[model samples]
Target: MCHMTACSLLSYIAIAWLKMVPMQTIRSRVQFMKISTLSLIFCASVVSGNVSLKYLPVSFNQAIGATTPFFTAVFAYLMTQKREAWLTYVTLIPVVTGVVIASGGEPSFHLFGFIMCVAATAARALKSVLQGILLSSEGEKLNSMNLLLYMAPIAVVFLLPATLIMEENVVGITMALAREDTRIVWLLLFNSSLAYFVNLTNFLVTKHTSALTLQVLGNAKGAVAVVISILIFRNPVSVTGMLGYSLTVIGVILYSEAKKRSR
Candidate 1:
């Protein structure tokens, strides 16, 4: 694998290791089941979304995909009945708005592609809520690692069925990727690793920072993913879209710094 893919993969492994301790203490039935349940939903989305993007335009995909944190805050508000820091909601609005503005151009309305990205955001949002909730739970004696022990295998299981069933050219794609685009193989691996890191970071930062911080970072991840994709794949962009992205990044930074200062 190349440096980018390898670095991404290593980040995930290190993050996973960080979760080992907290997960070890997870003994309660409810916590275990909750962990399993969240892993399945979120990881399934990550896999499906990744697969969809292989067929879909990267710009369109990332644009829709960026709204994840909005869903996250909504889920957090609903599930826990917890009041979010006002700045969290403020950061979220521009994040979703920027994504919508960015997605306005082309890519013939393939509803299938759109649905997958929506599912991705939904899954991510709910998973964030679950992570926030789990972090709030203690006395189980484990660290965030405890959650990953159950989550990792569950995530693998979650991805397997959808991948086999949904991906039409799974066999062809696999072979072609193996021979022609060996890098696609590395990309898939790195992508999955990033998904896992997303989870681990959600747990870690949720503890040290506010749910707002995690949500903001999640939005940033989408931005970073989009920028990286544009750089690597040369995804098409317009003046308006680029302007929106710039504003979105600036807004997110301001929002984060404002919240951080408040804290």
Candidate 2:
């Protein structure tokens, strides 16, 4: 996480130095507040999602995450009072129901993990909703890259203190481990660079489309990941699970067509 933040901070500096995005783009306090809030939500969601993996099967985690569209729609309506087409809401039912069906046999579920996963999913939805609303205003609009630059530093500020408090001998352990596995440093660097792109693309999508749309897209991505895992890892997938995933894909397609026709 530290590596991720450091990479973003360094990238932000480089971009600013190159005058690719003006430094003044993030000067407003209102903009800072919005970015900072998003940073906190993003950081917390990531941490909780990671921690949940210890107690819940990956299937369960994915299932819960598949509910993001539901929360996104709810929050979007609550915050903006913007009602989507009735078919849009109807489509989310199968999207969510299929995921639950896919993970119905998960045996490693725990209460804490379930709570954390739900929290993480809800936080992700809330972050998307808030980002869409906050950035939509003419006065608050910022280039997605510029917003990421500002958000990364604030997230670092919020996460650093928590890391210091929670992780014992973090620096000492990291140094000792790195000495035993020299590849650790390179792996961390690669992970950090990847993390930057994830954040950058997330912001870009939200900037270009509604948060609810992003959530729907995320479900499709999850389905693709499941297929890739099954193919590459030769993992066993139950017929029920396959059926559920098929339903989800079908729902996504129907939803997209519904949206297009509405437009």
Candidate 3:
């Protein structure tokens, strides 16, 4: 929580120093409301996602997350009534089916965890779609850094109370741990720096592409993370799971090609 807060503060400061837009010019109640809404969704997704991790294996959590594209497509259709190529819809089928197959093979699964994961995934998709819609309007368009500068502080506000309630001893624990291991401090600083970049890039991506495209990329990212984990951690993997993940990757590739050709 502290890391996130620091990163958000740094991002806001960096943007101000760059003079992209005066902080005063960015003030609007409507804009605040929009950013606050996104902050709430972002907070819910992160909290639920982390909570789900306690009850589900990391692999299962990721497998469930890989269904983000499906929800993205559904929400995009419902919200905008936009239609995609038949091939785009066809490619989404395998993307979902593969995740289902992989999740079915998980040795550990809990109903609560499954529900939370689903909620998190849906919220994430909604965030992306809503961000795209919000930024698509000529009146609402703001540069990515400016958007993050505003949104990050709102997120910090939303997260602060929750951190206090849920992690009451976090400060004490961190202080104690940091005394023994200065590496903890360095790691946190590194993490905070990366978090800023993550937020910046996320806004940039949503600005450049539709939410469905971002979700498709997210699905591919999950597959890549799984492969990295298997390689770096020597994690055990079943043949069925491997095959399912392979199918998802292929689907992502096909979906990318279809989207490019459509464009």
Candidate 4:
């Protein structure tokens, strides 16, 4: 959770400095405040979901991620007073099915594990739904850069205190910053710059795309992250996991196609 907060802070700094997005508004102060407040809740949920990963298996975490679209549908429906048809509500079937099929398989399933993963999913799904609301409600007022400006840094506030309270070797992180390790620094750099850029891109996508499309794509991001984890972290993958991933992608496509019909 702390780390996610820090990441949000880092993202904020990156967003503020890079300014060329074109979301002009008369209510700059109001919008800023609104954005900041929303982001705080947003960060809490995002951080909570992410931190849950520490206690749960990564694959399990990924499975939790697959629920995001369902949450988004509910949130969007409630906020917009846009009741989905029976088919729209039913779209969840493929989304969840694909996720289950794709989750690579976790060996050590337990009550605690189930609880942790469910909690994580709930957190992330809520966050995703709120973000979609934010996008739908205020996207034109916030291009990618402005969105970053408002959110990335605001997110870090959640992390700083957590770092001080929860973890040891805060000094090490500082010392790590001081060192000339291009490797480690690049990781931070990548997270701050590239990650934030991707976040902004996602905002743009969510704005132009349906909430369901955004979520479907977002799930794909999780799968891609898993692939990256395998490559960079050398995490082992199972055939079931691969199969599950395939199903998830297929399910996402079905959901997207179904969603497209409504639009």
Candidate 5:
């Protein structure tokens, strides 16, 4: 939580320094309450994702994450009444089925972790949908940088209290860790700086394409993560699990093609 809060604060500072947005004009352009609500959803997504990694192996966690497009499609329809081509809908079947298969084959399956990952994925999908719906109007619309400018500070405010309440003496713990190894502090700072660009690109992608499309892209990212994590962690993998993951990736590829043809 501390790391995440730091990332939010860092992003806020960077955006302000870059002068990407006019600080005084934000109020005239959009309602603070609306942006604040979206920031809450952003906090939930970040927290749930971080928590799930504690209980689940990266490979398994990312395998489940491959189903994000399925959730995104559902949320996009519910929030925006947007419909995709029938072929696009059909491609989701394998995307969903593969995850079910992978879950059955997973060696270190934690029910609680699974639930958390699902929540994280759903919250992420919801964030994208709500951002589009809430900010689509001409008057309310914000470019990716401006959206991050507003959201970062609001997310920091939302996270600080929760971090303090949930993680006892977080500052003390971090200080102790930093004293033990100065390298940890540098690593954290590097990670937080990277998060700014990640959030910027995420907002940019969602702005340009549909939310469901972003999830389809994320499926490919998860596939890459699966391979990289297995190599780094030496995590055991089963043939069934590999088969299921393969199916999921294939499904995502088909989904992208279907969407392109529809366009």
Candidate 6:
């Protein structure tokens, strides 16, 4: 997480220096506070997602992640009172039902891991919705890049204490690992860079479209991840599990069409 945030800060700075994005500073203490609060949500989403992957098969984890759209819709309504078309709402039924069905068929389901994955998905959805609501005003609003520029550092600050308390001697462990395998350093760099791009694209997507739309699109990404992980890891999957995943993908398609029509 620290590496990712460091990469984010440096990349944003370079982008700003290159004149690709305006280097806009936070306008006031209130704006800083707003971004700080959102950073906490971002941290929670990233941390929980990473932690869940420790105990859950990647395929099963992605399967649970497909539920983000349902949580996004709920959070969007609660936070912004924004309503979507009736058809759009209807489409989310299969999106949610598929996860419950998949869970029943999962071969190695861990209760704690399942809860963490759900928390991660919900946190992601909540962060997106809150970003739209909290930063909607002209004065408060920031471009995606600029928002991340401010957010990345604040998130690192928020995570530092948690890291110290939760994990002992992380720095020493990382140093020892790096000494043993030089490839570890490169791998960390590659992973952190990829994470940086993922976050950048996420913010850009939310900026151009609605938050719910971003999460709807994320459903497809999750499905693709499920397939790739299954292929690479050869994770044992039941017929019911595949069917449930398929149902979720179908629901995402329907939701996309419903959104297009409404638009």
TM-score of each: 0.71, 0.84, 0.85, 0.71, 0.88, 0.92
Best by lDDT: 6
User: Could you give candidate 2's per-residue lDDT for residues 1-263 as a string of tens digits?
Assistant: 66557657766765777665565466577677878889899888888888887877565566677777678889999999978799888988887777666665444547898889988999988997887776687877866676677777878888888888899889899899899998988888788877776655665686789655765677677777766756765655677777776766666666666666677
- Per-residue lDDT tens digits for candidate 3, residues 1-263, read 55468667877677677663445345578877887897788778878998997887676677777777678788999999988888878888887887777666555657899899989999998987887787776677766666666677777887888887888788899999999999999998888788787766665676778755765666667777777766765656677777777776777767777777777
The alpha-carbon deviation from the true structure for residue 88 of candidate 6, after best TM-score superposition, in angstroms, is 0.7
Is candidate 3 or 6 superior in TM-score? 6
lDDT of 5 by residue, 1-263 (tens): 44555556755665677664454336563467777888888889878988998988898888777777788799988877899999999999998888888888888778998899989988887887877766675667766666666777778788888889999999999999999999989998888877776776676687778755775677678889999999999878888888888888898888888887888
lDDT per residue (tens digit) for residues 25-119 in model 1: 45678877887887777565766687668666676676666666567667877898876687767876786677666556443336677777788
- Candidate 5 to truth, TM: 0.88
**Local distance difference test, candidate 1:** 0.66
Q: What is the lDDT of residue 50 in candidate 5?
A: 87
Question: Could you give the C-alpha RMSD of every candidate to the true structure, in order shown?
Answer: 5.1, 3.2, 3.0, 4.5, 2.8, 2.2
Q: What lDDT, from 0 to 1, does candidate 3 have?
A: 0.75
Better by TM-score, candidate 3 or 2: 3
Give the CA lDDT, 0 to 100, for residue 252 in model 1.
66
Candidate 4 lDDT tens digits, 172-234: 875676585657666755565655556656767867775566756776777787677567655
Give the number of colliding residue pairs in candidate 3.
0
Task: Output the worst ten-in-a-row residue range by lDDT, candidate 5.
Answer: 21-30
Q: Taking the candidates one at a time, how many backbone clashes does each contain?
A: 11, 0, 0, 7, 0, 0
**Candidate 6 lDDT for residue 54:** 89
